[model samples]
Target: MTFQGSGPLDTSGVSAGGGGGGGRIAMGGGLGLVVTVVALLFGVNPGDIMGGSGSTGSQQVSADQSELQERIDSCTTIEQANSDDVCRLIATKNSLNDVWPTLMNGYTDPDMKIFSGSINTGCGAASSAMGPFYCPSDETAYFDPSFFQELTRMGGSDGPLAQEYVVAHEFGHHVENLTGVLAKGQRMGNDGSVRIELQADCLAGVWAQHADDGPDAMLAPLTDDQIASVIQTAKAIGDDTIQGSGSNPEGWTHGSARQRQRWFTTGYESGDPSRCDTFATDDL
Candidate 1:
């Protein structure tokens, strides 16, 4: 993705922090090697950002300003040449802010936590092993670049668009949380879980459609093949695809590969939230 910001940011030696249990780490510079782990945490269902299952109940996470700032500063890519990760995060938020308001009317922005090995969220303490996620308890998103290595191992290529797609997917959950649709769907069980994830996938597609239009957008117009690659990545992460048929299909949280592709295409083609109505469909 080609982010068209006022100009690239100049965060050459910035750090990620301002929270407890904080420490400094060096930033990596290579685009090919840089990774991001996001937590898509929510109520009822754990959103994709942190790659967990279920939501937050009554959890309290005390804020430690300097430490939190330290964590944010520490969450950087390898080279830290132009602060691309920070720029990417800011640009994505700008994009989400652009579209989500149309769907929710007055949705407030959520805090984004960038960490390396682990982080403290309103939901609880989480390590990179848990993956990227969104925490509903604090209405924030968490990410670690380490998980991109796992995605590469699974045959997925890491690109700016791929990373943007992941970020947009997590933002999708934040949209659902504000609308209460996520909680409503969660009450519906596994079927609800599948629908929720599919909708998030659809939401990501919606964001992708408008990504190139914004001044601060980091994505270029996606090709059909590039789109397919993203869809394939989505399929690869499907509950069924990840766990396989050997696992009980009925207990699946994310939808099946077929279902995920179908929903993603549905949103990609239409570019409308209405087209992502997993609740009205019985296909899953």
Candidate 2:
């Protein structure tokens, strides 16, 4: 699950922000809770446990591009990425940008914004509590690295692949946007929401399959343990698993642990994006 060499990663597409100052306040909640609310409020979503959002009008925030560039400079090798989470993220983004064009036609690379506290996005203003999400309005993915720590508190793994799974999942949303899937409208109930979320998981698996495919592959061949770690992380974040109650498919937005794990496995095993059409499957 590690990258092969110490090569410079192209991080120009990423921007760093110091965080946002004001907005309408959305109650802070755990990862599961935030995701549920965001899914209900905004059709395009992802989940996380953290801070709250504000209600004020959108205020443009600037990113510290110099700081981000410094970090990118330090990550000239895969070894650096293996050691630093931020570097790993940049490397993963590089790999994603490199591989995605081959997977689909007309693929345009999306920008990633790393922020703290809260920030305004094209979708709206969001707080760190929102977790990592892709905004179709801006075609950008947003992340607050601190959420990874919260993820561990929620019984998720801290392994590298586990983290990559998250990045890949959000990026999967960007892919969904490009494919016109995000425009399909978010429906209530697990059946519709689960399909969207699970498809993202499958897309993450698709990324994993090609992450180590070519001579210029960013990562080394994935090991069984690494894949297992990702599965464990997926299970830990399952709506049912996080709820700690008996399965309730009716209220589920992200699917049960088993479903998440199964769909990810499907994409990983098939190594085909076409196989990840969760909407077509009645069994999901």
Candidate 3:
């Protein structure tokens, strides 16, 4: 799918205000360490792992502006978004901002941060290896663009929709946050976490359905093969596939490949956000 043009942006730490990080704290240990390690494979917010307070440690975050960040700020056209990974992320973010408001009443845009190495957040400091996560404390989605390359490493498509699915999934967490169901995902021990994660996949799918419709649409209509690739991407991040032989349903925080694919298909085929109620579905 193609994106629209001239969505110029200037973000501060991850907002419209420009500059570098607000601050940073030294990385931490104990439960923080455990959650970080676990979230490394998926887009889980570490703050939610603690049910609140995402402390990485006790050190201030590094504040230098990166060359990579400079390039992200310069990206203003669809061509760049199509050619560059970071640009694609920005474009996807813009598209999500456009599509979600119609389905969600009083929906507002979420702040986004593009970072390398480490950065500070409303929750706490986080490193790139933790993968992409949304900091509900600050209403921001954090991404280390380099992580997208891991799609192929995880046996998923490295195509545009796959990356967009990731972006949408993180934003889906924001939508959940607004709907007051995000806190339900705090129960990592039971099926609560898995259900929320699957719901996020479905919400991302909901965005995919209407991404190319309406005048505010930022993306071109998706092709059937592109949709299949998104499904492949959804299946790639499944806990069963990620855990391989060690996979256990008892320990699953995110759903299995089948559950993820089914919910995403559910949203795409239905094109209705109301149908994305993974929590109400016993079959999930």
Candidate 4:
């Protein structure tokens, strides 16, 4: 799953930030916490966790524009994305920009912010522990590349497709926002939350389906191994898998590992957005 050499990438929408010091918020109990423990447990909407407020006392960390440009410049060719992690993210973003318009009407690209440590977002201040998330209020996606390492630490594969799946999944949330499906997710209970997360997973698969379709496709066709790697990553991030021995399906917000893989496969096999309606199905 590598980008083609000819496709051009515009990383102007992305910025890089430096590390800053702050009291890291633990994942456990706190009513004042922006993202609730339930949201963190499920890995669902991050903006929902932030409670629609910007960081109050958190220190503001500015991105070094010159250094950010240097990183972008280094990824001048798609081939560079194949070798470098940051470049791969940039390349994937470009590809998503190209493919999404064809799938949905009135699609506007989301801004991407690459930060170190913690950063303030439209949702609120977020640490790398929150993983990659999309803030619908500002319509931006935030990522700490180090989260890729965290994914591997959590028993997920760190292969290229595995990484791309993460990026694509966040962008899928952007798609849900654009389609007005995200609002449905804001409703009460884990049922809505699980639907939202699983649909995003399906949407990620939809993107992967067409990622290498035509001559202009940025990536080469995915290999079987790459596909397997993505499935493994999806399983690793499942609520049950993450909760381990204390796994509780009744409290699950993101569905089980089998459900995640099945929905992703459905979108991949069908290559149709209509098939991704997790909310309509009785059996998710």
Candidate 5:
């Protein structure tokens, strides 16, 4: 990856908070973007990965956790951007803000929240255990840098683009919000639920398509291998793959890994929203 984003592009108005009134820490890298569809339908246990809740408000943290806050606020230099995974997360955030709405056609912009140990959201106060998630109530995406570490624990790749794919995927959920598809799909849980998640994966692929659209595209033109990397990630987190193996098939919500990769590739190769219609197809 050729580092792009440096400092906070729009941190001025962005409010910050800690679990224990320790102020807001940047907690950049460990976070991964997840969506509610994965939780409510997939049986993946959003509580296990999304962390905190919508009701916990913005006050949650420990004294020691507060100390971690200091490190998060620093200027993310290019050196750190290359050397630190957290910094790459920041890049992904910057990149998504740059790419998302352009693809969305018409939608409101949403803020990205990066937390370390734990944080609060419209969903509730969540610990890092729940993984990265987007809370519709706050209209903000929440992430804990340590989530990638958890992904590694699950035997997933920790590559930079791979991680960015996660962020892009969550931003895809925000797209769902603007499109009103999220609320509608939620109503169609189980069968329709998996399609929603796959659509988001397709949207994430759309982001990757233009990740480097600017004068200085951080990552190289997404190679076939890179595309495959993200596809592999989609597969690894699929409902069927997780369920069939260890994640309980009955609880399947996000679709099988095969479905995930298929949808993502559909978007990446075509880069057309029309092609991302998981709803029209019976595959999902």
Candidate 6:
């Protein structure tokens, strides 16, 4: 419902499956990635666990190709984009493409993949369990729309903006990849992981602030309710929230609920990507 019917959605860069028919489960480790879910959220290596560049992949998903095709086909109109998941993703991806370049020099769009079960990636093998993530090697963002259903079970909203927040968060990692901050995060401790994750959250807010702006705005004016939904999604995915109330900060990779909410609000209010420099701040 956030899309403004500005124009037809471009799904050319989007793939419903993995690159090169990706669907491979890695040996020894499950599906994993660094950005967003951060190596399956339990210290796994996405690059190491995922079978890398030259391994046999899988067509492991069980979704109906015809059904997926129908959804993609129907997403040409903005009205359809409002109601359909695939269409919404398409619209959101296009919106991000429109927004990021204005904020960063030499910004490039990341490949957005929607999949079920397992998929192969430049970073390695991945499953829906690793949640949404960005692979720097391929410069792509991977998403499992089913993860939204899981978000709902985790006490997060299933609103369109909430879903978009996750998309933006993954793309935030793409921005980090471009700026070389993601590499810094790779060598960080738990505290560093928290900083990177919070920075991504903030960058998501920066996207929201500008998504409906400019002459070619692809989205309608964002609302308070929608922003609140995004906040709920942020809180829902917080490591402290996921680890229960008294979770130790030492063991938490992503920041706490308060920190995530604060950082996102910082970005939204500032509407500046420069304000999202979590590594430079000690407040978190």
Candidate number of the best lDDT: 4
Local accuracy of candidate 5 as per-residue lDDT tens digits, 27-124 = 32232233332243222213223433233233334443454445445534644555665566566676677676666677666776666655656655
**Per-candidate TM-score against the hidden true structure:** 0.73, 0.85, 0.83, 0.87, 0.78, 0.86
Lowest-sum lDDT 10-residue window in model 1:
30-39
Ranked candidates, highest lDDT first: 4, 6, 2, 3, 5, 1
Give a tens-digit lDDT track for model 6, residues 1-284: 78886467788778776433332335442213323343343222356445433322343333443455566766776666778778888888888998998889999888987766656777777766677777888988877777878778888899999988888888888898889888888788667778888999899899999998866688899999999998997887777788676577777778888998999999999999999999997888
List candidate 4 stretches off by more than 4 Å.
18-44, 50-69
lDDT tens per residue, model 2, 126-214: 76655677877888887777778877887788898888888888888888889987666364444666788899999999999999997
What is the C-alpha lDDT profile of model 1 across 90-188, one tens digit per residue? 456655766677656778877676665545567655555555667778887766655666766765556555666677777888888887878887788
What is the TM-score of candidate 2? 0.85
User: What is candidate 6's local distance difference test score?
Assistant: 0.76
Q: Which regions of candidate 5 fall more than 4 Å away from where they truly are?
A: 2-68, 77-79, 245-250
Predicted structure 5, TM vs. truth: 0.78
Candidate 4 minimal-lDDT segment of 10 residues: 51-60
- Ranked candidates (TM-score, high to low): 4, 6, 2, 3, 5, 1
* lDDT tens digits by residue: candidate 3, 88-202: 8888887788789989998988988887656666766566656788878889888878888866787889888888988998999999999977877665444777888888889
Top TM-score: which candidate number?
A: 4
Point out where model 3 deviates above 4 Å: 4-42, 48-64
Candidate 6's C-alpha runs over 4 A off are 18-45, 48-66
